[model samples]
Target chain A: MKKGKWGLIIFGLVIFIVGVTFPVWYGAGTSAPAPVLDMDTPVIKSMPNKKCVEDTAFIRAHHMKLLDAWRDEAVRDGHREYTAKDGRRFEKSLTGTCLQCHSNKSAFCDRCHNYVGAKPSCFSCHIVPEEVKK
Target chain B: MKLLLPIIALFVVALLAACFAWAEAVSLLTILAYTSFLIFAAGFVYRMMKWAKSPVPFRIPTTCGQEKSLPWIKTHPLENPANAWGAIGRMAGEILLFRSLFRNADVKMIGGRPVYGSAKWLWFFGLMFHGSLLLVALRHLRFFTEPILPFVNGLSALDGFFEIGVPALYLSDAALLAGLTFLFFRRVVLPQVRYISLFTDYFALLLIAAIAMTGLLMRHVYPVDLSAVKTMVAGWLVFAPVVPANAGVMLYLHLGFVFVLLAWLPWSKLIHMGGIFLSPTRNLINNNRSVRHLNPWNPAVKVHTYEEYEDEFRDKMKAAGLPVEKE
Candidate 1:
């Protein structure tokens, strides 16, 4: 038990030393770079200039319709139809097929959103379809 | 059987990690880190294959509500799921909310009388730890991508809502550290838990703690050049590995710790993340009686019918003056 305690103490000390020395070593030798952006320059565009969502309900309805269409397509493609105990037959899609039609992600949404500085992280996991012609 | 091999591999990895730490050579550390990852990947695939081959003769999903029975009896279909939809709903709840664990209880002897109490502490800690870690991971997206996302910025704002530090400390980081500490201490201090605890459990907790601690130290105590770190990470992500010459040793240690954690994940109990979906109790609904569940993987076999067995015994039954099927 004593040995174990001492081992933990030593490990903690090593980590602490490493933590303390790292910045001193890295920062000391390196020359500081000039600030990339000017303070006076607008960091982001005004939100009023962005494409407005007039009706969220309309958007949701359209989204649901698209979802239903995709679901139907998935079933038509010989995907295994699972009959739920509730008597609903549904087929799961592996990758969302909406990207087939809506291929150029940036053109579809990113253009205006990027201009408005409203970038979303969805693209991190998802890739824009490169093959689809604009 | 495959699990035993990873345990052995972990020991070999620990040795290598120790050696790299001592030597402090970038090449040696990189080799150690990537090699560990390769071993982990191979082991994961092998283990998954073994699982896929394993025979499950029963539909044994754990149900919390009334089973489907007589027509007069009311069935709690959603909770005790007699069908796939209900099962899916239950699975979603289990996965998202840890529904089963939320309902867990701890038993204790109170003055020689057995008592059960809510074990919500585990659920609370688990939720906080997982949720905060996820948020932290999302917040890290800025480092990997060329242009930072608005959602990442929004999430960063939300995490640093308290605005406690000079650079505005992320609340998720504090929550994550606290949650991990609680979990680690729970394993060590709790008598029953401690008894069941293996070195692997302690090792995993320690490793995560180390990772979190290093990250905190890097951010607060030893701030690295964010742009440089981002460039290095982005390069790695794009398959163009750049070992920046002046990248802080602390960053290397942090990355090393992360790689170690990733390698350990598949082999350790952390595989529970994947295993939860595979768990018979959580995934399966209690509808065995209602539905004829034929084991799809069961091999076809010839069977002797009751009539055939009775036919052979009929002559012996007549000699003994017993009722015979023929008579």
Candidate 2:
């Protein structure tokens, strides 16, 4: 018999390396750009402070938690008002208050959600904003 | 000290990574990850090459069934493979199902004669650990992929179907932990097993458990920004690693454990992942009867032929009255 099947062994190793280091070649020359949130909506642009209910960093990280809290408070406890960190009062409604400024759901909401593969069930019951369908 | 040493070492490693992360030493962490990966890849190739270069002088397949013989006799192809196809099938069984280990039994002296009892816990735990590790690794593909694989999403949904918590708990997470725990306890709880257990074994288990715990803490307790996690990991894949502003210490600890495991794998028993395929006893076909196998290391011995011997000593044998065929 031959000393070793070098051809077959090398081929197997190549396959293993390729499979294990898939991300290296898969992401080669590819840039994973973060989703660009368009805050150019007329409602947002018209605001004097030009800010969100919470700070940008806080909202970016804990938006889901905030939305969850809002959902429970509005639905279960019938608490419809929210007091912001900046001592501002706002109605705790997705469509009525939150989406008022962020009117373009696709540009503002769907971008990051799709990028991160977050399948939020918000639209399952609530209707998608009219502008989003356009 | 064997147990305590590795535990302390792992703790120190995690602390080092945590400190680096706190200092926002993104470049250092990236360099560490890359260096460890390089070591793993190099060590893998080195070990494989070493194994390949060493020649096997004989067919030494560890057979458990009857070898091929007369036409009337039956042969177990999987257990005693005589052909390439049979060998491949046997290998598949050994790799996927761990066929040999499945038949494990504990032999004890009950009434002076040996008594064999089922010891399938080892096999079960092995399967659980490997199976759950595979699932967890697959689930992590989402971080590497740009758009994220659709099957990954489906797999995640299936794995987290129980929906025990707010973000939903993954079944693999629990299974992996249980598997690690069982594997660890088996060494300490069983006297025979403990006798053979090395410090490295305990170290590997504890390190893995630590990684899993840190990951769980990030997911359930602290709730770190997953977006940041993905961004950093995906960035590393693309050779553009950026430490996100809000990346937590838990993430660093998890990463530290993973890096250490990667670097240590090729040098440790974990190389069995690759070594399983290269094992001569399991991989070689049982074809000694049908074919000739030359020993590569056999020394060349000078032989004196009968004809040559007779030619040299024919006259002397004839004079001495000894019978000679040549004369």
Task: Give the poorly placed runs of model 1, Cα more than 4 Å off.
Answer: A1-134, B1-24, B28-42, B295-327
- The deviation in Å at residue B158 for candidate 2 is 2.3
Q: Chain B TM-score, candidate 1?
A: 0.82
TM-score of candidate 2 against the unseen true structure? 0.90
Candidate 2 on B1-327: residue-level lDDT in tens? 767888899989988998988888878889988999999998998988888877777888999998887878999988898888998999898889888879999999998999999899889998899889899989888878887888988998898887666466899999999999999999989988888988899998998899899988877666666677777777888778787767778888888899999999999998898889888898888989888887877899899998999999999989999898866
Q: lDDT of each model, Cα atoms only? A: 0.61, 0.85
- Model 1 chain B: lowest-lDDT 10 consecutive positions: B1-10
Q: How many clashes (backbone atoms < 3 Å, residues ≥3 apart in a chain or on different chains) does model 2 have?
A: 0
Docking class of 1: incorrect
Instruction: Say which candidate scores most in TM-score.
Output: 2
Please identify model 2 stretches exceeding 4 Å from their true place. Answer: A1-4, A69-97, A131-134, B108-113, B305-327
Specify the highest-lDDT model's number.
Answer: 2
